[model samples]
Target: MTHVMACIDYSQSSLAVCDYAAWAAQKLGAPLTLLHVLDEEKYPAAADLSGNIGLGSREHLLEELATLDAQRARLALEQGQHTLEKARERTVVSGAAFPELKQRHGHLVESLSELEAEIRLLVIGRVGENSNRGAQSLGSQIEAVVRTIHRPILITASSYRRPEKVMVAFDGSPTAYKTVQMFAASQLCEGLPIHLVMVGADLEDNREALEKARSMLISSGFEVHAEIRQGDVEAALHVYQSEHGIDLLVMGAYGHSRIRQFLVGSTTTTMLRTATMPVLLLR
Candidate 1:
């Protein structure tokens, strides 16, 4: 069975992610693990400053504050455990089996990567409402997790509502083929219509890629439509999605190094920033 790990934080966006994760787990017959990470270091300074009980002299007060910080870290771990329990219950009610709820007290990316050997997919929310306004689009947490985790990540924007129309951004790359294969094998888009779109400066290559992608999808028993568009990739995708009313956008992340994405700017990254539809990013 596919092992899906969902990063949950008890936020509204995280709840939406949980819902999508449950849907995916059910569709793929996969085992789901809801993971919650408590960054104990993030609270170190705050705990030391906030819980100063003034035990006696300056030295005693400092030691008391350090002890209090440790207590606070423990409390955070306990709270995260409780939240994961609730999330697990929600997943079970949503037609998924009781997922393994994991609570780790450490850096989010480190904890997640430690489980990479067991994880096939990672699901995360776009951004929490309480997050900083500027952080909503490609937040630090999302970026960090994506950069570190080699497993495919499904970033959810809102509660997924049975995708009826899925748009595949075909570039003829190996990773893109994997994305196509994933859709072909799963019931996630069983009765849904698929749109194979190839965007590039070269019209001939675009046409060829679209044809190849269409054939692939057709062979998988899907009613497929192909489109070849010119100009900027992000702009083309936005226009196509808007015109065709696409519910989900699928794409592959390609780059040798994280910094190389700066030059090539991954289709997944551009779509995450601009696309109106939810995106399934395959690595």
Candidate 2:
């Protein structure tokens, strides 16, 4: 069975990720691991500019700051633990297995890599509160981990409602096939409606490819639908999703290297930045 890892924080977005991860794990009969990384150095104190204070006084103030930092870290850890426990309880009530909780101290990306061999998939929240700026945005840790992790990553945006209509962007690539196969076996897509969409400038071979993918999904018992469009892949996808109310999008990440992604620009990257729907990116 597949092993799915969810990088969780105390945020509501992370809770949403856990909800989806729990459902996905149950569908695949996979074990789920809820992971939290505690960064002790996330907050830094300013240097004491008041030179009037004696060295002993400065040392005392520094000690107090250190104690406060430790207390805050402990509180955050406790909250994260409680959140995961609640999520596990919910999963158990839903007939899914309770997920294991794992806590590590260090960089989130490095810590996740330590378990890369064991984790088949990673689920993470789309946005988080910025520690330094105090604004909501895509967390740097999540972006870095997604680029670095070799396994497939499923990103949850707001909340976890079971995806009923799933759209796949196929291009006949190995990564695309991997996504198709993964969805075919996943509980997320089992008996769910699927839309197999292929976008290109022309219909040369895309029509045939769409038919092939449609057949595959239909054979698997999905209410399969196909679309072949001519336009920018991202634009066309966004239009289609908005018009049809697509719930989730599955696409292959198309780039051999990071530099290639920059030079040619990937469809996956475009959709990641622009698509409002949740995306499942397969490598």
Candidate 3:
């Protein structure tokens, strides 16, 4: 069976991610896998900085570098294993049954790419352990990972609770319509109240698309609310979410230039970083 995988690092946000993933697994009745990727490129002790090693000292320096590299590799392996163990334990305690743990080496995205087919849903923290800045700045790999993976990714904010009210940011793009179709068919949002909203100047086109989506969702037994909001896309969305007590935000991962200007491209990055609630991005 496909699994719900949670990508965790040795960060403050990792536990939060695990908790969300566990809750998702329990809700979706899917097996859980806790993944921790060890990126060796992030650690570089082999580089020669001195630049002034005599022939006599060159052999010794090379030997020293090799030894250091070996030690670092060993330490990294140990740390990865420990992190996975803790993640598994935490997820299990959070109500996931027999969650699997895996540790992979190399770029995080590459590792995820290899495991993509097996992942039904991906849950990851907004930033990893390496992020020194606070929640305002996303992890270096966040954008790349989200753009590369076609699977629905749940970007965990500082905390998570199973959402009762979810808002979908629809822009009338093929991607947005497909997201509505998927949401209507999937058990992920089965009984939750959904708001299909579009932010634009014209209410006419927005109303048509929202009506179409609302009808489809209603046909599938979902309680759907359709609306058109005006103003800056991100600002309006966050305001609506806060005012309505929206616990989750769903939207397309990418869209055309016009919608991208408002929702998907760089604006998507900003929203993910600043959103107080979790975001589920569909491709």
* Candidate 3 segments exceeding 4 Å error: 43-57, 261-265
Q: Distance from true position, residue 237, model 2, in Å? A: 0.7
Tens digits of per-residue lDDT for model 3, 1-283: 8899999888888888988899889888999998988776864445553565676667667768767876787788789889889888888888899888888867899999999999999999988888887874677788888768889999988766778899998878787889888878778887899988888866677788778988989999998888898899889999999889998899887766555653344667778878888888887
Give lDDT: candidate 3, residue 191. 87
- By lDDT, the better pick of 2 and 3 is 3
lDDT for each of the candidates? 0.75, 0.71, 0.84
Which lDDT value does model 3 have at 218?
A: 96
Better of 1 and 3 by lDDT: 3
lDDT of 1 by residue, 2-27 (tens): 58889888677777777888988887
Model 2, which residues run further than 4 Å from truth?
43-68, 131-137, 185-187, 215-223, 255-266
Using lDDT, give the best candidate's number.
Answer: 3
Please give the ranking of all candidate structures by TM-score, highest first, separated by commas: 3, 1, 2
lDDT of 3 at 73: 72
| Backbone clash pairs in model 2 (N, Cα, C under 3 Å; residues 3+ apart or in different chains), count | 0
Top TM-score: which candidate number?
3
lDDT of 3 at 227: 86
